[model samples]
Each structure stands twice: as structure tokens, then as C-alpha cells.
Target: MKLDKVNWENYYDKIKGRSPRPLLRAALELEKETSRPNGRFAIDLGCGDGTDTLFLLENGWQVLAIDAEPVALERLLAQVPTDLTKNLQTEVAQFEQLTLPPAQLIHASLSLPFCHPDSFPSLWQKIEASLVENGRFAGNLFGVNDSWAVNAHMNFHTKQSVEALFANFAIDYFDEEDKPGRSTAGSKHWHIFTIIARKMSDSSN
Candidate 1:
């Protein structure tokens, strides 16, 4: 799908009020085990409607929520509780143009797959470089077998490719689903990888 303005707007409208993604929940649990400070920094890429953004804020994390669609931001701001709004900052931008900052967590949800294929590698590099040692990344990536894989505009990876992408990290949770199932947008035949990985400690060579 092209995912133009209309498509994104429709998507936001359809998925409004949804709960945080399971991958994000698992990542948060891993973070809790480390007993970090009360307020950690997170970047929510393609944070449509702020579902996970709200959850992060409620958990005392400062969030920088980025989305390409203005409507998504408007809906997200509207849904956030006023008390937690102070902890949230939003950016209206596309993945190709995003400049990531060092953060404790980077939650992409179903967003990264939407990045343009030609730009995905560079974006992925930025994502990797922006994380502090041990920072976690929780997100979904489309598999080559997915129906949308033929789009050419979007990025899809084989299992090996996906695994290679996490070479510098330790996979805490990796669930691959390849079957005929309806998507959140009511589309069928979904093939996705839900991943939660923590960056490994650096070893000076």
C-alpha cells in the first residue's frame, strides 16, 4: 500500500483507543528487571494515536512520539490524559527524515515496515546508533512472505535477514507468525515478526 495521507488518516481513525502492543509490554517488563531510574527516555516511532505513548508516560517514561500524519498526532494528544501530557513530546515527520536521539527504549510497533525500502537501511542504522548500551528495541517487522512484501516501496526481510539485523543485540523475545490472519485494518494473510531485543554490552577489541 502507498500509505498516503488518506490511508494513514483512515488507519488512525480505525485503530483509535487501542491498547499498547504486546511487544512493547514485554520490553517494558525487561526494563523493569534492570531497576532503572523512575523516568527513562523513549522514542515511539510512528506512534499512531499514542497507544503505547500513553502507556509509556503513565509508567513515568518521557516519550518522543513521532508520526508522519498530523491527524495521528492530533488524535494522540486528544487521547492522552492532561496529567501525563507534560511528559510527552511529538514530532510530525517521516522515518526517512527522522534523526533519532540516544534513548533507553525505542518502540516502533508496526511502524518500521512502513518505511520506504530505499531508506530503511539508513533508518535502521540510525536506530541502532541512537541507542545506549543495553537499550531495548521492541517492534514488528514484515516478513518476505507477507502480502505487502510485493509493494517494493516497503521493506520486508527473510528470517535470516531479520536475525542478522539483531547481531549486535540479544533477542529477548522473538515470535514469528506466518499464516492467514486478519490485520488490524481488516486485511488478511499477515506475516510478521514481533521482536524485543536489548543491545549487548560493548567489548573493546
Candidate 2:
């Protein structure tokens, strides 16, 4: 399938009932080990239909859910339980123009790869800077061999490149998958990286 030809509306509908991404689940479990209090905040980049945002809000995190599509934000807001609405904030912004706030967790799922390549470095820098020291980042990135890698607008990385992006992070979990898979778009060869890393303190860095 051509990356440019994906039908995002259909894709969103397809994943509306899916479970939260494993990267998010792992990050939550690992962060819980620190015994940090709840009511902390998270930024859900590319929140889509709010599947993950709903999970975070239910878990007691104040969430700022962002997506480039207004419809995506609408879907997210609609699914949020009424009692959980106070803890939720929604934003419609593109990665290139986004301004991030400090957060205990930055969860992106499989969204970051769609960032225009020219903007991705700056966007990543923002992500890193917005995280509090010892804060966690849970996300997926497209690998160099991903079928969609040929799309000039998307960012794909080598293992070395991905590791280099985490130089200031204390990585606790890193896994790669090169297999056949189905995405919201369609069936394709997936070369992906799943990461759970904690930002290190200035002195530690």
C-alpha cells in the first residue's frame, strides 16, 4: 500500500476497539515500579481515536492528547468517560508547529514516523526537552527496512540511529520486529522499533 494513499478515517475506525499499545503498557508497569504518585501528566502524541488517551486518563494521568486532525481529537474526546473528562485536554496541532509541555510520560505509539523528515529532529528534541528528568518515553519508530520507508515525508531509522537519539536516555526496553503485519492502512512488511526509555538527569547525562 502506498503511504500517501492511506485512508485515515477507515484506519481510525478499524483501530477504535483495539487495545492500548504494548509500549504504553510496558512503560506504565515499569514506571509504577518507582512508586510515583498519580495525577502526574502525560502527552499523547497523535492520540487518534483516544484508545491510549482513555487508558491514561483511567490510570489517573492528566493527559494532553494531540493530533494533527481535528476529527481525531473529536473521536478521542467523545470516547472519554464523563468522569474522566476533567483530566483530559485536547489539542489540534501539527508536529512542526507543536509546543510541548512538561510531562511524566510522553506516549506516541506508532505515530512519530509520519512526521515530515525535515521536522522530525526538532520534534524529537522537543519530546526530549518536555520530559521531566527520569520521565518515561513510550513509542514506536519505523525501521530502515520498513515497507513504508520509501515515503520521503516519513522518518525511518537504523538501530544505530535510533540508539543515537536516546543518548541521554536510560533505556530499559528496546525491541525490534521485522515481520508481516496489518496496519490501519493494510497488510505490509513491518520493520519497527519499540522503545521504553527514561530520561536521565542533567548530571547523569
Candidate 3:
């Protein structure tokens, strides 16, 4: 579904100063143990306001920050520290239209659930295919019980389906939050799956 540009700006404005998502922080921590930092590439998918993108850049990773809303990218670029500008890139595109490069990590945070259900499967495949062998995906998926599950424009998953999405990868961190919570929008029941999984090499599986 097409979101109004102004509403998108307000939504992002509310979340502008938030800290990076935990899944990404954990993914980076894992990176610290398993690989060298030099020239590591990462994609910050649906990176609203660049919270996670800035974190990735500050930590020395080359970041490709993407958001469907141009205002989001504008705010992100405006806030980035000048010293870290060399390693950052930005794109304004929706999920279904994205073309990603092979990267060591992809952080989607709360983004993927917005992809239209019809296009989500193919998008998922692209994610898997774009990762280098053993590369990681750190992201969130909304569950079937989410308050917004009734919204036809958004994608929601069952627990079984969520697991199925990772059939070829090894799950590193998984959390299912199915409880009432207050969001920037208001109070509602949230069913969210936070995941960090590693792509498996064909021979390793």
C-alpha cells in the first residue's frame, strides 16, 4: 500500500532519536567475533531515519541505507556525522523494487512486514540470494496475531511460517513478542519476531 508522504515523515520523526535495534546490535557483536571489520559491507533495509545505519557506519562498516520514503533518507543524511560520510550510501525505494548487492550483513529491523504479501516471497528469496555465503540477516517479521494483521497491505506470519522463512539458514537469535505494548502510534497487541540468522553455504547444509 502507498503511504502518504506526510504521514511517513511524522512516523519517522517520532522515532528519529531512537537507539539501534537489538537484533542489529547482536549481529554486529557476532561480527566482531567471527570476522575482521575492514571493508565489511552491510545493507540497512528500511532503515528509517538511519538509526541503525549510523550505528553501522560508526562501527566501521560500509552501509547502504534504504527507505521507501525520501524524507527518511533526507533526515538520515542530514544527521550523519561528517567524518563517516565516506562509507555511507542511500536509496529511496520500496521493498518490492529493491535490488541488493552481495553483502556480509542485512539489517531490516521493523521493515519487512510492510512488503505486500504477494511480493514478499520473492523479496525473501532475493534476501537469501544476495547474502554472501554464511552472511547474516538481522530483521523483524510481524506475526499473524499482530494488531495490524487485519491490514491487507501489510504482511504477517504464523510461527510455523516464520520458521519456514529461514529453512536454509541457521537461526542465531529468535524472539517472539506477543503481548500488549505501547508504540509511537498507541497501545495495541504486538506480535513481532526478531531474528538473526546466517545464510548457509550449500556444502555446509
Candidate 2, residue 158: how far the Cα is off, in Å: 0.3
Model 1 per-residue lDDT tens digits across residues 1-205? 3333347777766776677888888888888886455348999999987888989998889999999988888888987898888888999999999898788899999899989999998998888887778888899999988887767778999899999989999899998999987765566667899999988864311
> Can you list the residue pairs that collide in candidate 2?
none
Model 3 worst lDDT run, 10 consecutive residues: 1-10
Give the number of colliding residue pairs in candidate 2: 0
Task: Give the least accurate 10-residue stretch of model 1, judged by summed lDDT.
Answer: 1-10
The residue-by-residue lDDT of candidate 2 on 70-159, one tens digit each, is 989888888888999999999999998899988889999989999999999999989999888888899999998898988998999999
Q: lDDT of all predictions, in order shown?
A: 0.85, 0.88, 0.86
Better structure of 1 and 3 per lDDT: 3
TM-score per model over all chains: 0.92, 0.94, 0.93
Clash count of each predicted structure: 0, 0, 0
For candidate 1, the per-residue lDDT at 153 reads 74
Ranking by lDDT: 2, 3, 1
Ranking by TM-score: 2, 3, 1
